[model samples]
Target: MAFGKSKNRRRQDAAQTKEAVKGAVRSHGPGLLKAILLTGLTCAVVWGGIELRRWALSSPTFLLKETTFSGLQRAAPGELLKLSGLTVGQNLWALDVEMLERTMAAHPWVRTVEVRRHFPSSVSVEVSEHVPAALAVLGDLYLVDEDGEPFKRLQPGDTLDLPLVTGMDREDYLADEAKTRERFRQALEVARAYAATEPTKRERLSEVRMAPEGLVLVLADGTEARLGEGDTDAKLQRLSRVREELRARGLSAGVIHLENRARPGWVAVKLSSPASERSGASQ
Candidate 1:
């Protein structure tokens, strides 16, 4: 009976120790569960971030599929596309807009350029090109803008009824752009004056040759108008008057000199052979 009591006591002790261990585990159960949940959340976030990055980089949605150009006149689309340096299947977000603009604007025809990147796969471009105002006869003919900026070489396809500005050296212009530009401005003024005048006088303008003495106008009828350097407007007015008087009398002059600034009112005219003989025959 004593042995049996001792065995029962040992069983009781074992039961109590098991219960104590269970109680300890239960007390720390919430903290263990929270630690496991935090680790799982951190791992999930890292995995999700990696996947998002991968998707963003390799996704077909962000790839450049189309490129479009607008506001173009003289600029060729193929040349514009070539100059843009943008290619299909390129990354849209990786496009350098500034670099693209610089490259396109470097084209001879492009006056200004605006580059835009559209999301989900497109690029749009705005190109402003230089408009030809005159044909500048340097070594070879060059197209000059209204602002006197020489932009491009004359092509056979370009059939513009613009006036020619001669006696300008390309090297001289390259050496002194400012001086050349000033001369161009004066040439424009002369051209504009002709435009404003009557068609009879305007039709006579063939070429404007810039001379060291002044501006010389070479007419279609082999007549030369010598406009010396003083007041250009005054010179033009005198020229118009002389042209009108001569035209009214059905007379023609070989050289009309307005260079005598000392006698601004008096115009000296050298008659052509036909007109000279006619004047003599009339007198």
Candidate 2:
């Protein structure tokens, strides 16, 4: 009887051990499988990416693709392309777009530039140029943009059809000139006003001399208009009214004084004496 009891106890103990082992395996099995699956997926993704990049770089057709440029005239295409530090047969995957754009913007005439990779191999460049607004007579001469900031040295004939700004010394020209630039602000306004009336007014603008009295406008016909520093809009309106009235009356004048706009409307207008009459008047 004692031996049978011992045998039953042993059987119960073995059964409990088997159940514990089964339970442990059930809990850990999914975790092991999941880890294996995740590792495999990561390896597959990394390998695919590397293979794709390698294939793209190894393709000869992409390396041989041609690069193109637009809106480039002053600078040679080869020169600008060289500044980008790009060459034929370079792996497109290794190209740095931001660096290329920064390099292109280094050009003096380039106001804005865009650089983009052309798929597998080549790069395309598009550039916007700076338009000259005024010319500053520095030692080497400088081209000033519309904002009155002097950017780069000028070449001969580069400032054709642009207004010439005089009377500023080298010190004023080299400085930022933001405050003094307002001196020409009214001149720009007048130039535009004339242009609105006549497109060829740009050719008529000879020089803008900044003097102690105020701004002076020298027209191509040797007619001078005194434009004071204050209340320019009012002054121009008065000038326009006077011009219209004179034209209606078939009268010609040379200098138009816009200095005083009192109740009496004081203005000075000139008429060129006939060549024969000028001799008699001088005599």
Candidate 3:
């Protein structure tokens, strides 16, 4: 009877162990299967992306067939295309748009450039050229853009009848680029102020000389209009009235000093002849 009881106890223990194993498997089986499926999906996606990129780079279907250029004023399409190093037979997907843009931007006249590749067979380039605002005499005469950047040297046949900016040294520019550019911008501001105030006298504007004292506007007839910093528009207006008065009096001025910090509204005018005159601009 004792032997039979021990055998039955062993059988009961084995049966309990089997049930526990089955319960654990039932709890964890679905989660394990889901994890495996997710890993397979992620690997498949990565492989697909790699293959797609490889095919796009090597496929002839994406070969560039045509290139179009727009917003080209001073630059020729052929010239820019050559500079870009983009060929018709090259794969559009393989071409670096940023590199092409950088290369094209190296051209002196290009202020901004955008290069885009159209799907399957074409590319387009858009460029914005710099507008010459004034000529900066920095050792070599350079074309100053509207933003006051001296972009290109004045080449032969580049006939721009703009105001000449003097007293900007190239050595000084190299030493402190920002300060020189600020000076250039200030001179440009004076020119614009003069133009806005006296549009009819635009043609009379010849040179903008940067004197140690301030900015001096040298007219076509060799008259100097001294304009110091600040209140540019007001000073230009005063100058316009003074010029009209002089014209009415059938006289021409040699030097018209409108920038008197001591006596703010007073203008001193020296006649082109032997006689010199000082007058109040406020009147």
lDDT of each: 0.81, 0.68, 0.89
Instruction: Give each model a TM-score.
Output: 0.72, 0.71, 0.88
Relative to the unseen true structure, what is the C-alpha lDDT of residue 194 in candidate 3, on a scale of 0 to 100? 82
lDDT of 3 by residue, 133-233 (tens): 99999999999998889999999979888999998899988999889889999999899878887777543688999989889999887889998767888
* Tens-place lDDT digits, model 2, residues 1-283: 9999999999999999999989988999899899999999999999999998888778775673667889886666777777877777777677777888889788888777887787766788888777677765656666767766667788775636666666676676447567546644555666666545434553366766676777766667666667655666665566566656656977555666655434224556664433311111110
By lDDT, the candidates rank as: 3, 1, 2
Pairing residues by index, what is the TM-score of model 2? 0.71
**Candidate 1 structure quality by residue, lDDT tens digits, 7-43:** 9999999999999999988999889999999999999
**Runs in model 2 with CA error above 4 Å?**
1-21, 138-140, 157-159, 167-187, 198-203, 210-214, 230-234, 240-256, 261-283
* Regions of candidate 3 where Cα sits further than 4 Å from its true position: 1-20, 201-203, 275-282
Q: Which structure is stronger by lDDT: 2 or 3?
A: 3
Q: Candidate 1: lDDT of 32?
A: 90
State which candidate, 2 or 3, has the greater TM-score: 3
Among these predictions, the greatest lDDT belongs to 3
